[model samples]
Target: MTDAFYDSHCRVQAEKMNDLAVSDPKQLVALSEQRYEAQIRNVCSYICNNMERSHIVLLAGPSASGKTTTAHKFRKMLKEEFYVNSYVVSLDDFYIDQCRLPTLPDGSKDLETVYALDIDCIHQCFDQLTNTRRASLPTFDFHTASRSIITNDITLGDHEILIVEGIHALNPLITEGLDASKFFRLFISVKGEYSLNNEVVLTHEDLRFIRRCVRDYYHRDSSLERTTGMWASVRAGEKKYISPYKCYANLTIDSLILYEPCIFHHFLCPLIEQMDPKCDIYPRFERLYHILQYFAEFDRHYVSEDSLLREFID
Candidate 1:
């Protein structure tokens, strides 16, 4: 969990990735898949063993740690044991309207900050679930940037598990005054302890930056310049909104792929090449480019969708 530990591991993984790139990328992908499955199994068992009464599990993690995807996978695995199902409620649906929200430090809309969430409504939702009462939830409208509590009702049936995934899911403000015995918490992060040459530490932010670069370009049609420019603010918001409550979890999931940055380099480098000189991305581009030079690239086809990195890379 210290920076030094992660940095050292990043160096070892980078060297390992270099060796795998030249020797066998397929084996490297297989290794990542194995680790991903093991992590899922570990967390699932922890939940099944510890969850006694109502199974309201709070899944918290840094951005891009495959929390949503892991929820889906965990639900599937839980069904194999019993006739139970999980309801995934995204905190994204609770966001306050962007038009009404306050501005960010750099004057852009601070959409990701916890202040943008309506605390009272979230508390009510948790209350409804815990009490076994029917309650309609609010859905945020991204297009018009508004919110409306659902008029339709949903009653929790027998054997229903509520799996909430979000940046602020662990904030005590969201679950304050609730019975601690009725809830379980898990903290997840791309605790990638990979290193390059044992000197440079590959922080989670490094992995996330590349993921955002690829996702922004491919999915959002955003240029690398824009994503790179917004990174500092994004990180600041996460620290403010998500990180402080990590210790509240009963379990932690390390969602990291040792050889991922190698695969990410293939997609990210080309995108980096397109950034204009005047864009604010030049400094990070130069730094990451130097980092990329230390590790070799691998074929994209070797990567599996089950890999923790598939959230961004796929």
Candidate 2:
């Protein structure tokens, strides 16, 4: 279940728990990492036990919810421990061309909707993989916002599974008419909120925003303005396309790392200090910066190489 505390009880809980700044950061960091890995191991064990019934794992999450990292790690653990060959199939690669996409009310491309994907192509891929244990997949280029002609062909041997990761992974359209018994679905996100002085201080939404800001700046060449400007739409898309289907998931994973707020705070504080305050999104960052100050910073070097935090920070 998603750990949440509100009111006076929540504040007392956060105050008692948020003591890493005064404690040994190194020891606490190791313990925190272990806790997260423990959850992954348990999930893998469950999936392996049910291998006879399910070969396809659908992983769905909202923006900046660490879906990509969890999907890869889940596949990695399955192979390393159980010797189950699992392949991660990114639904992002199946997106149709941007020009042909359906538009929203403001004339902007509705890229978040499941309709943006080629439904027929997905069915074809599933058929091929289930029957022949091989499928040639299309590659979508984000820079061009179009599907590349180049194909990625993948083959699965006996005892292998395909893990599909995307916002629409849990949508019924993706699995309609298919045998529901053949799939295991997971929904992951940061579901916990931080409280201070009996009031909510930091929320999962704020945490995700900070993550996207840092990720886009470092990897996507996007400015703070660009990411913040689109924050509303990203959230709206999550509620409309992602959250409603969360109930369809067989399991939900709380992707929150207790020490992650500090890691993000350390990097994001310095980075946002350089942005233009006059920008519309500056106020949001200001609010985040305030809430972040209550938490202690964690050293990035101590973060393990396989840490999911590596997906965004490094």
- On TM-score, the leading prediction is 2
For model 2, the local distance difference test gives 0.82
Q: All models: lDDT?
A: 0.73, 0.82
Misplaced by over 4 Å in model 1 are 1-11, 81-83, 105-108, 148-154
**Candidate 1: Cα lDDT at 213:** 80
Question: Which window of ten consecutive residues has the lowest lDDT sum in model 1?
Answer: 1-10
Off by over 4 Å in 2: 1-14
Error at 243, model 1, angstroms? 1.6
Each candidate's TM vs. the true structure? 0.88, 0.92
Candidate 1 structure quality by residue, lDDT tens digits, 1-314: 12222332344456656676678778767766776777777777777675557678888877677788888777877777544666777787888887768786568787767778888887887788788645677777677888865543556666667787888888888888877677888887877645655565557778877777887788888877677667777778788878898988888887777677778778877766776767666877877776777767887778785555666766
Checking candidate 2 for backbone clashes, the offending pairs are none
lDDT of 2 by residue, 5-33 (tens): 23444322355445643476676567667
